[model samples]
Target: MTAKLADKYGPWGVVAGGSDGVGAAFAHRIAAAGINVVLVARRVPVLEACADEIRAEHGVDVRTVALDLSASDAVARLVDATADVEVGLFVYNAGADDISVPFLDKDVDTHLSLVRRNCGAVLEAAYRFGGPMVERERGGVVLVTSGAAWAGGASLAAYGATKAFDLVLAESLWAEWRGHNVDVLSLVLGMTDTPSLRRTLAAKGDAAPDGIATPDDVAETALRHLGDGPTWIHGAGDPTGPSPLGALPRRDAVLAMSRSWAEE
Candidate 1:
C-alpha cells in the first residue's frame, strides 16, 4: 500500500491482539505512518516489546494494555481503558481456536469459551468503541475473520461459527455506518505463519509443509486491502483471482475439506 494512502487513513490505530505476529505487523505499519498506537494483549512483557520497537523505529506514542480478552468483562475494561484516546482505526483481531478434537470429543465449556472470546468480544469492541468513531464521523474498523468463516468446518465447528458471526456482523455494521464515514472491513485470512499455527502443528505432531503465509505477508496484504478500502479481503489465492470462493455459499464444501485437516 502507498505510504500516502496509509497516512490518509490512519493517525491513531488500536490493535486488540497487537503483541505479536500479524497484529504486531499492523501496529508497525500504522506506526510507520506516524500514527500513535494503542496495543492490547494479555501479556505485559509482550506488549512492552512490541511497543518498544514501534517507539524506537517510528517515534509514535505506544500505550500497552494487559488484559485477557477472553474474560467476559474484557470489552468494558477495554473501552474504559482507552476511553481517553481518540483512535481513528480499530482492528478486532483477537481470537481463540476451536477445540482440536472430534465433535463428540470436545468439551462444552471449551466451545462456549471460544465463542465468548471470538464472537462476543469482537462484537463488544466494535460496538462500544465503534459507536464513538461513528459519532466522530471518521474512523475505520477492521475485523480479522477466518476463511473458514465463509463455510462450516466441522473440525473447527465452533471457531468457524464465531468467525462467520464476526464477518456478517462487520458487514452489517458497514451498511449501518456507511453514510457516517466509519469504514468497516472484514478480513478473511487463510493459514498464516504465527506462533499459534506452529504450536498447533506441533501439538498435532505434524510436519511443516508448504504454502503457509507469514505474518508479514498477511499484514501487508491486509493493509493493502484496507488502503484500497475494499469491504472484504480474502487472504489465500490471488487477490484478483477466482473471485474468492468464500463469496459463494459452500457450507458443505468447507465441512468436507475440514475433515482432511481434522485427522492431521
Candidate 2:
C-alpha cells in the first residue's frame, strides 16, 4: 500500500496546518508511506517538533514552513517554498474556530480572518497545488471540512459558511478532475478530539463528549479512501452516503443545528 501510494502520489506531500492533531497525523502517515512531506503551520516550535518526529520515525524527508494560512500571500509563499519538489498530495487542514460564540458576539475582523483562512486560502491552495497535479496526471487533494457545513447553526456562522464552501469546492474539483487522474476529497468531520476542539470546549468550561473521533483515525480513514472522492463523512455508518440531515426540511435542519449549539 505504501509503495502504491508513493508511486501514484509520491515524491512529496504538503499538509497545511501540519503541526499537531489531524495535520500531524496526515504528515506521519504520508511519511510512513515513503513520501517526503512539507509541513506547514503557524507555530514554529510545534511545526519543527512535528517535522523532526516524522523524520525520525518514518525515515523520510520532512520540511517545516511556519506560516499563517490567513495571510493573503500564503499559497504563493507555499508554492515558492516547495518549488524544487513535486507535491503529489496536498491537504488543507488548518481551518478550526476556537471560539463558538454567536455571530454578533465575535468581532468583525475575527470573522473576516476566519473567512480568509478557511475559504480564500483553501481555494488558493487547491488552485496552485492542484493545477500541478492535474498537469502531471496524478495527485490527490483533501479539504478537511466540518459537519457544521451541513446546515447553519447558532454559533457556527462563519465557520459553517467557510466549510460549506470547501465542501462544494472539493466536490466540484472532483467532478472536473476525476477523468484527469486527480483525486479530490472533501473529508467532512464531526466532533474530533483535536487540540483545537479541546480549546474550544475548554473555553466553555466543558470537556469533550464521548465517542468523538481521534486525529489519527480520521487521517488514516481519509488517506485510505482518497479516490472515493466528492465527499467522505468520518465516523458515519455510511461514509459515502448522504448527509445525516438529508431528509429534514431545510428550516428544521437549521433549527436542529441551532438547538444543538444551544445545548452545547
Candidate 3:
C-alpha cells in the first residue's frame, strides 16, 4: 500500500504544520512510503528536527519550510518554497485549537486567525497545490478535521465552525477531482494523544485524559486508507457512515455536544 501510494502520488508530499503531533506523524509515514517530504511549520527548530529525523529514518529526501500558516502570505511562501519540487501530496494538518474556551471568552482576533488558517489558507492550498496535480493527472490531499464539526457546542463556536468548513471543502474537492485522479480526504478525528492535544488538556487543567488515540496509529490508518475518502472518520465504526449525531435533532445534538465539551 505504501509503495503504491508513493508511485501513484510519489516524488514529494507537503505537510503544513508538519513539525509535531499528527502532522509530524504523517510526514514520517509518508517518507517511509518512499515519498520525499516537505515539512512546513512556524517552529523552525522543530520543523528542521522532524525533517532530519525523517530523512535519517526513511532514507528519503526531506525539506523544511518555516512559516506560520496563519500569516497572510503563508500560502504564497509555501508555493515559493516548494516551487522546485514536484509535490504530489499535501496534508493541511495544523488546525489545532489550543484554547477551548467559550466563544466570547476568547479575543475576536484569535477567532479570525482560526478562520484564516483553517478555511482561507486551506482553500488556497487546494487551489495552488491541487492545480499542479490536476495538470499532472495524479495527487492526494488530506485535510485533518475533528468531530467538533458535526454540531455546534458551547466553547466550540469558532473552532468547530472552521472544522466544518474544512470538512465541507474536502468533500467538495473530492467530488470535483475524483475523475481527474486527485484524491482528497477529509480526515475526521476524535480526541487524539498528541503533543498539541496534551498541551491543550493540561492548559484546561486535565493532567491526563482517558481514551486518547495514538498519533502513530492515526497516521498509519489515514495513510493506509487514503483512497477511501471524501470523509474518513478515524476509529469510527463506519468510517463512511453518516455522522454519529446525524439522526438527532439539531437542538439535541447541540446540547449533547455542549455536555461533551463540559466533560472535556
Candidate 4:
C-alpha cells in the first residue's frame, strides 16, 4: 500500500489545517504511506508538535507551516513555502465553523472570515495544486466538507453555503480531471469525533452522540478511496450515493435541516 500510494500520489503531500483532528490524521496516514508531508495550520506550537510526531512515527520528512487559511494571501504563502517539493497530494481540511449561531447574531466580519477560509482558500488551493496534478497526469485532492452542505438551515447558512461550494467544486474538478488520472474527492463528513466538534458540543453543554465518525477512520476511508472521485459521504451506507435529502423538496429539506440543528 505504501509503495503503491507513493508511486501514484507521492513524493510529498500537503495537509492544510493539519495541526490536529482530521487534518493531523491525514498527515499521519500520508506519512505512513511513505510520503513526506507539509503540515499547515495557524497554531505554531500544535503544528510543530504534530510534525514532530509524524516524523518520529513514520520516519517521513515533515514540514510545518504556521498559516491562517482565512488570510487573503494564505494560499500564496503556502505555494511559496512548498515550491521546492513535488506535492502530488493536497488535502484542504481547515474549514470547520465552530460558531453555530443565527446569521444575524454573528458580525459580518466573522462570516467573511469563514467565507475567505472555506471558499476562497479552498478554491485557490485546488486550482494551484490541482493544475500541476493534471499536467503530471497523476495526483489526488481531497476537499473536506460537511453534511450541512446538503441544505441550508438556521445557524448553518454561511458554513453550509461554503461547504456546498466545496462539494460542487470538487465534483466539477473530478469531471474535468478524471481523464488526467487525477482524483478529486469531496469528503462529506457528518458528526465527527474531533477536538473542534467536541469544543463546539461542550459549548452547548452537550456530548458527542453515539456512532460519531473518528478522524482516523475518515482519513483511512478517504485514502483508500482516492480513486473514487466526485464525492464520498464518510458515514453513509452508500458512500457514493446521492444526498439523503435529495428526494425532498428544497423547502422541506431546509426545514428538516433546521429541525436537526434545533435538536442538537
Candidate 5:
C-alpha cells in the first residue's frame, strides 16, 4: 500500500521556505493529506503560485507570507504574520550555502549571510513557533538539515558546519519539548532532485545525481513520521531506503552513496 499519514497533523501546517524545492513539496503533500498550509518565503509570486496549486489540487486552505527569514526581525515578523493560525506541523526547510570559494577567498558578507540564513533564522523560527506548539501540547517539527552534517569537507566547510548546527538544534529541542507532546525531527537529507540542487551543481560545472528523489518523496515520508517523537536522520536517501526509525541509519552509508553519485 502507498504510505499514508494519519490526519492528526492536519487542520493547519506551516512550511517555512515553502516557495521552493522540498519545502514546496511538503506544502503540497500536506495539503493533499487534508491540511491547511501556510507558506513563508521571500518571493511572493512563487509562494502564491505554490499555494494556488495546492489549493486547486486539494481544495484546502493555503496562505502565503513573503519575507526573508535571514532578516534581523524575521522571527518576530513571522510570528506577527502567523499570529492568527494554529500550526500542527512546522517544517523549517529554508537555508543557503556560502559561495563555494576557498574560505579565505570568501567575502565577509557572504559568510554572514550563510550564518544568518542557516543558523540564525532556523533558531529564531523554531523558538517562536515551537513554543506555541508546546503550549498547545501537540505538534511536529521537521528541520531540513543535510547529510553533509556528518563530516567536515573543504568545499562544503561552511555549509556542513551550519547543517551540523541544525542537527544538534533539532535534537536538543526535541529533548526539551518531549514532555509537551511536541515531536521534533532532524531530516539528514541526502541529495534530492530539486531546482536549487540542479542550479547549484550546474553553476559548479557538475551534473545531477542519477537516483535523486522528488520533493514529494521526502514530503510523504515527513508526514508519515509526524508525531512519532524525536528522531535523528528522520528521513534520508531515496524511497528505496528504509522508512524512518525502521532501522538505525549509518552516516557513512548515506555519505558514501551520495558521494558516488554526486556531480563531478
Candidate 6:
C-alpha cells in the first residue's frame, strides 16, 4: 500500500498496545508514511524501544505513552498526553487475552477488567479522538477484532464477547462516519503469531504449529484497507461479504468454532 493514507489522514496516528506484535507493525507502517505516531503500551521499555525503532527506521516523530489500557484512567491519560497532536488515525489494538479458560475459571474482576479495556476504553478513544476527525471531515479508525466474534466458543466467553463488541462498534462507526469522510474499519483476525498469541497457546499447552498470520502481514493488510470500511477480514476470499461460517447452522457453527479453538 502506498503512503497516500497518511496524507488522507495526516498529522499523527495513535496505536494502543503498540509496543510489539501487530500494534508495533502498525506504528512502523504509519510512520513510514511520514505520519508522526503515538504508541501506547503498558511496559515503558517495550514502548520506548518500539518508538525508537520507528524513529530509526521510518524517521517519523514518535511518542511513547506507558499506560495500562485496562485501567480506568487510560483514555484520559492518553487524551492528556496527545492533546496537542492532531491524531488523524486511531487503531484500538490492545484487546489481547492470554488465558482462554472456562468462563467461571476466572474471577469476576478479571472478566470485568477485560470488558473495560476492550469496550469502555475503546469507546472513549473513539469519542475523544474520532470527534476531531469528524470535525475535520477526515481521519480513520481501525478496531482490531477476532474471528472469535463470529460465534460463541467454549473457552471464548469474555474474549469473544468483547471482540464482538469491537466488531459492532467499528461497523456502526463506519456507517455513521462514511458520509462524513471518516473511514472506520473492523479488522477481523484469526490465529496470528503474535507474542500474546504465543503466550496464550503456551498457557493452553498447545504448541503445535498451525496456520497463523504474521503481525507484519496483518498490519500491512489493515492499513492498506483502512478505507474499506465495515470490515476487512484478514485472509478471507470475500473480506466484505458474509461470515465464512454464515451458511452453517448456528449450532453447527458454534460446535465447529469450539472444536477449532480447542484444538488450536
lDDT of each: 0.77, 0.94, 0.92, 0.94, 0.76, 0.91
lDDT of 5: 0.76
What is the C-alpha lDDT profile of model 6 across 1-264, one tens digit per residue?
A: 546977799889999989999999998888988999999999898889889889999888999899989899999999999999899999999998978889999999999999999999999999999999999999999999999999898989999999999999999999999999999999999878888888877876767376778889999989988888799999898888889888999999999989998876
Tens-digit lDDT string for candidate 1 (150-213): 5676677788788889888887888888788787887777777776667777777765568777
Show where candidate 5 strays beyond 4 Å.
Answer: 1-7, 232-264
Stretches of candidate 1 off by over 4 Å are: 1-10, 96-99, 227-231, 236-251
Clashing pairs in 4: none
Clashes of each: 0, 0, 0, 0, 0, 0
**Candidate 3 TM-score to native:** 0.98
- For model 1, what is the C-alpha lDDT against the true structure? 0.77
Worst 10 residues of 3 by lDDT: 204-213
Residue 57 C-alpha lDDT in model 4 = 97
In Å, residue 1's CA in model 4 sits off its true spot by: 3.2
lDDT of 1 at 178: 74
Ranking by lDDT: 4, 2, 3, 6, 1, 5
Across residues 1-264, which tens digit of lDDT does each residue of candidate 4 receive?
567889999999999999899999999999999999999998888999999999999999998889899999999999999999999999999989986999999999999999999999999999999999999999999999999999999999999999999999999999999999999999999988999999999999999998889999999999999889789999899999989999999999999999998998
- Candidate 2's error at 129, in angstroms? 0.5
Candidate 5: clashing residue pairs, number: 0
**Shift in Å, residue 259, candidate 4:** 0.6
What would the C-alpha RMSD of candidate 6 be, to one decimal place?
A: 1.2
Write out the backbone clash pairs for model 3: none
Q: Which residue pairs collide, candidate 6? A: none
